[model samples]
Target: MISLTPLKMLVLLFSCVLSGALGGYYAASFSPVPAQIAIVDVQALVKKAVEKNQAQTEDDAKALMTKVKSSTEELIQRGVVILDAQSVLTAPEEAYVNIE
Candidate 1:
């Protein structure tokens, strides 16, 4: 049998509202921005690399892999999310990037 006086009830309501406002502010402040996504045609990139470098020997393949890895890492460091072209069904033209 809890009996709340009007003043006590008002205080409780005020406390709840304050807590909710603070929580919302905290969440909004800490929320991450949506990442920009870029779709890459990995197969095309590989084909182009092979054609340019004549990737027949193991060393040539390794060099091609190194180049691809560096480029991907550079994009990631720039806060861009890279997705394989094949995995994406459809994307905006702006989402496609030429990594050549």
Candidate 2:
């Protein structure tokens, strides 16, 4: 059987206590700070989305709407022709994604 001398036991106990205290000290020293910075404040930006529409004017919006309506009518006119000669491939031919 092995034995621990009293002095050796005292040294071992002290070493264990010292190791725990240092580990706790290091953990506290390296812990993260609780704060962050936002690049943009959305509430303020939404309030500024239109100081008065410049590039995208009321007339421009109307023109785009008319273009969309015309394109939609053309698609409806040729709906069956498009429905035939179909395959899994559509737009983005390399990637196959299920619309549903």
Task: Name the best candidate (by lDDT).
Answer: 1
Residue lDDT tens for model 1, 1-100: 9999999999999999999999999999999865488888887877886777673787866876677667778778988888989999998887877766
Clashing residue pairs found in predicted model 1? none
Predicted candidate 2 versus true structure: per-residue lDDT over 13-66, tens digit per residue: 999999999999999999985322112222232234444454566775565445
**Reference-based TM-score of each model:** 0.49, 0.32
lDDT of model 2, residue 18:
100
For residue 94, what is the lDDT in candidate 1? Answer: 78
* Model 2: CA > 4 A from native: 33-100
> Lowest summed-lDDT stretch of 10 residues in model 2?
35-44
